[model samples]
Target chain A: MNWKRYERASDLNGALTLLDRAEGTGRVIAGGTDLVLQLGQRQKSAELLVDVTGIDELRGLCASGAWIRIGAAVTHREAAASGLLREEAAVLAEGCGMVGSPQIRNIATLMGNVITAQPAADAAVPLTALGAELRVVSAAGERWVPLEEAYRGVGESAIDATREVATEIRFRRPGAGAKTRFFRLARRKALALPVLNGAVCLWRDGDAGRIREARIALGPVAARPFRARQAEACLTSDRITAALLEEAARLAAGEATPRTSLIRGSEEYRRAMIRLYLTRTLWEMLDIG
Target chain B: MDHGVKIRMKVNGQWREAETTPDRLLIDLLREEFGFTGTKKGCGEGECGACTVILNGRPLLACLIPAAKAEGADILTVEGLTPEQGLHPIQQAFQDEGAVQCGYCTPGMVMTAKALIDENPSPTEAEIKRAISGNICRCTGYTKIVAAIVRGAALLRGEAATTPAGVDRERVPQLPPVGPG
Candidate 1:
């Protein structure tokens, strides 16, 4: 009912020790944008909070090697401004920039979004499209999990991030001519949660520029962020064309299992918008915008 | 509900400490404990930027932030904007450009604008809009508020004060188009 202790973890060991001890009674405060609200609303019954914002290893966004490693604690604002993310991962950078606002983005982390496991989380949608891998760590040691396996349900996760820290999310930079885009349809332009959102990424190859591989992710249309495998398959046969985009849109919407909600929209509208936005996202990627 | 966390931080150039429950919000810490109340608490949730503050050089919502997170960080609020001589350029520009109406959102607006101008000496109109999109002001309809921030940038740059900086009348470049949500 009340947080009995607020322990500041200066490093990863200190954080692991405290978390390992608190067990289920502790909540980790990375950006504190979500946890602080949850704590006040009594949504999380943590008697102790282990602040991991100070952990050195849990910070930084580096693109040095094969993969671009984004620290779990890196705030959305930081990601939006980073030259590396802007270049190699502009979809993620733009998505992060769209989250809540400049104020909220200044403190919300990519890992928090990934771990929130929400269907339409701005950061998670792009990370899912990029096939990002999450390094979930605890005192028990380390394990890497694909972003998909981390989700248990909406706002729920199979990974015990309370017991384990999400150290980083990493992915290889897309190759040349590869297109990545994240698009969302919200009620208002600013500070509105997505009514529906999706991200698309495709690898371009051959002199004719055929789509060699593709990944498509859409949210709030399923329990977790739904990957449109059938839609992605629509692109595999040939280079992009009007017919291909139409087929992909149709398949992507058909792949969705959206629930009818009074706030978001009807199930029919969601499916229709998915088709529309999917086309625009593809058009934008092809520079036909 | 009594025994609490002992926390310390520098707020508006003053090093201060406060004892509170682990669930204490940073907005309360500044207003109640530190007594620098220029920052307003509009929404306890992160939805409203009325509770914005600069922590360690980044603007974050104080209401959504726990007090413990302020430890060892340099925080800037509207109270710290004055340097003994006169009002901060931002406050001055806001007044000159008629940015304030109801005045409830002024402090938070000033802080957010301060962060924007500090980071970008002269942001384009679109950049200015993106910077303050987090903060909401109902009274000014945002035109004067945007104009004031542009003027503030000019004042900070020691440029010609005749016209507001960054094209105040210019329509901001459109952001990425959205779909029906």
Candidate 2:
């Protein structure tokens, strides 16, 4: 609730210039659902707010041959309603929908969710599962960073907010006959942040139905959202069965090192849920449920 | 420091400009500056849905929105939903189905319900549950509220609301024509 001068940037270039000049003094505001709330709680402060909601290039989803591009400033509601996202990355859409509530989804941006780097960020798990990349724009130029490399801390991101404005998030769409599912173990039904959310994506490879790739992303368990590579490796063979899924779940459970927070989830409960959700999600994805 | 910033917001249907602090919450502006007090504030945090309003045709928690950020946005509160002519269908349905108990959560519930019906004209019980899941009601276990939304959808469909003798049946807008009736 501290005093700050707010200015609406005309375009992405304007925003980049403002960010470059102000260093840490200016913060980009899009949607403002999270940033405004954080400001009110005194979690973040700035001398100037560069509102970028009106920036055209920073909104909407675009699809190419294999890559799907999601604008950083696209609202969660837009992401939830995107048919391309639903077809290509349904988990991302469903996860975005589950954040906060319908109201928060209307104004909260995907970039904001990614930048917050909260371990419990619902959309982060799916992004990690899809191998999404962060496209950042600064006064100097543009660069791409993998989603996993973007996080540095629980609530901190490696992308310098002072110098960069996240412009796009891109990921490869799963090929033919691929199946993906997003599931979360939240305390309550709506508006509540995830206690421990996860995403599982598997693709078919030839006649054997290989798990071409599997991503086991866990949230609220570490400094940043992470994919359980050991678990993913366990299921990346031609043969995928209930036993293999159980093993993957067991491995995923071991990867998480959850800490106790005001939110009433313990390390024990989260680990259990990770294993439970992994098997359940695997079953649900394979239509063996 | 003169910390207040100038912002323009579309309250109901009118565009009004006001100078407010960068941190001024939306609930305070609705009640104090705009004088439309129908939107209540229960938990200052986003947990409670008492201060729900329609932002860009979608329901959102107004209490969590900063007044400065709502610039040039369309906001529809409970007061905005009702017309000078009469009550909106959601309001009538709440009255008809006896959904209001303490009448505190009604405004937020109405806004949330409006969003649900607007998006999905005939939402299933599960969808309705998901839509209002953010709204917490200490009284009225939400059975009647859900029923009221169903009844309101029927009313909007122009399917004869079956009102009592004294009610006017003409105020509610009719649903758009669809497949052969």
Number of the predicted model whose lDDT against the real structure is largest: 1
**Candidate 2 lDDT tens digits, A243-289:** 98899999989987886667846778778888998888887777553
Q: How close is candidate 1 to the true structure, as a TM-score?
A: 0.92
Model 1 over residues A1-289: C-alpha lDDT tens digits? 3577778887888888888888777777778777676667777668778877777887889975688998877989889889988887788888898888888888889998887778888898888889999998888899999998889888788778578888899998886667788898999888888998888888877535788888998887898878999999887766577778888999999989998899999999999999999988887676542
* TM-scores of the candidates in the order shown: 0.92, 0.90
Write out the backbone clash pairs for model 2: A100-A191, A103-B60, A119-A220
Pairs that collide in candidate 1 are none
Per-residue lDDT of candidate 2, residues B87-155 (tens digit):
898888888887889999999999999988897888787888888887888998998888888777767
The digit string of per-residue lDDT tens for model 1 on B79-152 reads: 98877888888998888777888898898889989998888999888988888888888777898888888888
Worst 10 residues of 2 chain B by lDDT: B160-169
C-alpha positional error of residue B47 in candidate 1 after TM-score superposition, expressed in Å = 1.4
State the TM-score of candidate 1 restricted to chain B.
0.87
| Native contacts recovered, each model | 0.84, 0.65
Best-performing candidate as measured by TM-score: 1
Evaluate candidate 2 and give its CAPRI docking class based on DockQ: acceptable
